[model samples]
Target: MRREWQVFRVATTYVGTVVGAGFASGQETLRFFAAYGRFGLAGVAVATALFCLFGITVMELGRRLRARTHREVLDHACGPRLGRVMDVAITFFLSATLTVMVAGGGAIFAQQFGAPYALGTLVTALLTGATILAGMRGIMAANSIVVPLLTTAVVFLVATSLHDLGVGPAFSQLAPHPALAPARSWWMAALLYVSYNLALSISVLGPLGAEVGNRRVLLWGGTLGGLTLGLMAAGMTLTVGAHLPEAAVEIPMLYLSRSHSQVVQWFYALILWAEIYTTAVACAYGFAGRLGQLWRYREAVVATICLALAGSGFGFSQLLAFFYPLFGLVALVVLAGLMRRSWRLGS
Candidate 1:
């Protein structure tokens, strides 16, 4: 039972690490999947498969390497030269994830709650900074608590939306919103979406994998996590489909929840912030961790938070629209490297 519980915990953390502000806000789903209409759900399937495959590989590699940080995992996969190059690239991408989360908080405040963007940015920074300061255990604890709420909120929204629209009619409502889509086709969107998230998640997975007991725990935890993420994406995609008009907004899911009731809107808004906070913590910690133990802990963290806050000036959608696909390209390189290394090792 204890062993099973641990695996569950690992799965929750993995899901939490990947399902950040972008995912919860409905921004990412809208960009990657919802914009393509019904075909996007097929993209969700593609992403789900990749998420499981890479999630397992990353965790298992972390266990083998006993890696304290994502840097080691990259070094092992790409070897010294190319690994160093990709390491720098991933570190920057993770930092961008932090920036994106910060921007997301501001968007939630502005778009969902009608609050000042600066106020939202400040609150997000403080909360995320506190969590990162608490270290890896802190990120794990936050995920364990927050991810469940996020899951519940998503399920509630999906159910309510489905009740209103019916699955067939709901999907029938979907139309190509090319302006919001990350890619022209669903398959391309799926690859970009998974690549982008895996880039952000390896930071947490790298260390968590090291602490995991065995292959069963790693495989089960990863499969569960990936599936959970895919489920949430599908749920949000349905909600977005039902509310096609609202799908163009920054936080489409929140807009759908609001259509149901004010109470539901308030609930999801809070949950959205929690999602942002957790992902911000992951990104910040990952960025600092990737520095290779060369910087002072307190200073590095504080500086990283400040830089992220500054980067939030990019605004939520602009950053998400541009940086995510760009980083996805870089992550594709890392993913390719990992696959080649795994093939050579015959494991």
Candidate 2:
């Protein structure tokens, strides 16, 4: 019973780490999957399989290597020279992702509440800076509560949308919005989606894996986490597909929830904001921690938050479309190296 509980906790954390601002906002889903129409769901399926395969592989390697950071796992998977290259790339990507999250924060505020975008951006930056200065305890606590709420919110929105549209009609409603899609095809979108998320998640997952007691826990945790993410993605894809043009926004889920009721809108908005906050903190911490005394701790974190706020002006969708795919391409190299290493280990 205790072991099972531990597995669940690990799974929850894994899901939380990946379920960031872009994910909860529904923009990422819309861009990667929903834009493909019904084929998007198939893309979600492909992403699910990849998420499970790589999620477990990463944790398993971390256990074997006793990795304290993603750097260690990268070293074993890519060899020293390539590993150093990846380290710099992923670290830079982490900071860029923080900027994306900040932009997402502003979008949620402006789109959902009609608030000033800069107000939202500054609020998110302040909260993230505080959490980082205080330490990881706040992040863990926030994730514990927010991850479950996010899952429930996604399920609720999907079910409500389907109920309104009816099954056959909803299924028929899906149409490819290629202009909104980040990739050229459904398969490419799915691969890029998983690659970028895995790249971001390894910062937390690698260390978590090293701390776990055994391989069994890592296997179960990774499987459960990957499946949970798939379920959420599928739900978001269906809901957004049913709603079409309305889903074409910076905060699609929040907008969809508002069409149902003000209460639902507020509930989803708060949940989304919380997720955005947690993800921003994780990215800021990872970036600053990696920098290691180029400046004082407070100075480093504050500087990061300020940089992200400045970057947020580019707009959420634009930043996400540009940065995420680029990071995904880099991460794909890391994934290929991991697969080669895994095959050799098997042999």
Candidate 3:
């Protein structure tokens, strides 16, 4: 029973790590699954399965090796020579992801509250950097509080939207654009989405699993996180299908929240900030960890804050658009290598 509870706790943390500003705001869903039209639900299923299977693989691998950081896990998974390559790729992607989260938070603030995006980005960078510098206890404590509130707010908004528009009709309306591919092929879209997210998740999930000190906890935590993401994807699919046009705007989820009440709107804005903070912290931690490993910086915290602030200055939408595809390619390579290693290990 204690183990089961730990599993739930760890899972929430993993879920919180992955479901950052983009997931909370419905922008990621809009860009990935919902963009696929009716087949979007199919994409969601594929993404969920990928999240669960790969998430478990990552956590279990970390548990087996007692990995203290993502570097250890990747080194074991990819072996010495290839692991070096994977390490570089993962670090680069992590930095870009951090930039995206910082930028996304700023965009949400500006779009929803009429604040300057630069101001929002700077504030987000400072808060996230501070939390990470406080150590693992601080990260876990912050996540425990924020994730539940964010999940509840999203559930309320999605549930209310579903009630307004019957599920069947909502899904049916999206049928016209089934199998819409962001890239050249449907398979590529699905693979890119999974690979990109899994690559980024490994840094947080690996160390997180090690911290829990139990394989079962890692398994359950990963499962829970994947399930949460799946449900969020489904909810976003419905919400997007019902009101597709809203997704084109900057703060679609906020627009959805407005339908409920002013209180809900305010609640969601707060939740969005929390979600963004969680993501920024995870990404920054990953980058800082790698940097610390490579250098003898006296003040790692200050260095990380500087890096995040500099990255955030690079416009939000431009950064996301550029990194999203670049990371997808890098991640695909890493995923292929991991799969090959798994095959050999099994054999």
**Best TM-score goes to which candidate?**
1
Give the 10-residue window scoring lowest on summed lDDT in candidate 1.
338-347
**Model 2 lDDT per residue over 74-132, tens place:** 89888999999998998888889999889988887897789999999999989888887
lDDT of 1 by residue, 1-347 (tens): 47788788889989989998778888788888888888988988889988888888888888888988888888887788888888788888888888988988988888778999988988998888888788877888899899999999999888987988898888888887888776778898898788778867888897888877477888899999999999989888877866776567767777777676788888889999889888888888888775538788877888888898999998987887778788887888778767776554334
RMSD (CA, Å), candidate 2 to true, equals 2.4
Off by over 4 Å in 2: 114-116, 133-138, 293-299, 344-347
Q: How would you encode candidate 3's per-residue C-alpha lDDT over 1-347 as one tens digit per residue?
A: 48877777777777877888767877777767777777777878888887887787777777667765678878877778878888888888788888888887787678777999888888888898888877666677788888888878888888888888878878776732333345755456767888887888778777776777776677778788888889888888778766876555666787787767777787798888889889888888878877877664336666776776788877777887778777888788667756665554333
- Candidate 2: the clashing residue pairs are none
1 against 3, candidate with superior TM-score: 1
lDDT per prediction?
A: 0.84, 0.83, 0.77
- Candidate 2's displacement at residue 186, Å, is 1.2
Please report how far candidate 1 places residue 72 from its true position, in Å.
1.2
Q: Candidate 1, which segments miss by more than 4 Å at Cα? A: 110-115, 342-346
C-alpha RMSD by candidate, in order: 1.9, 2.4, 2.4
Ranking according to TM-score, highest score first: 1, 3, 2
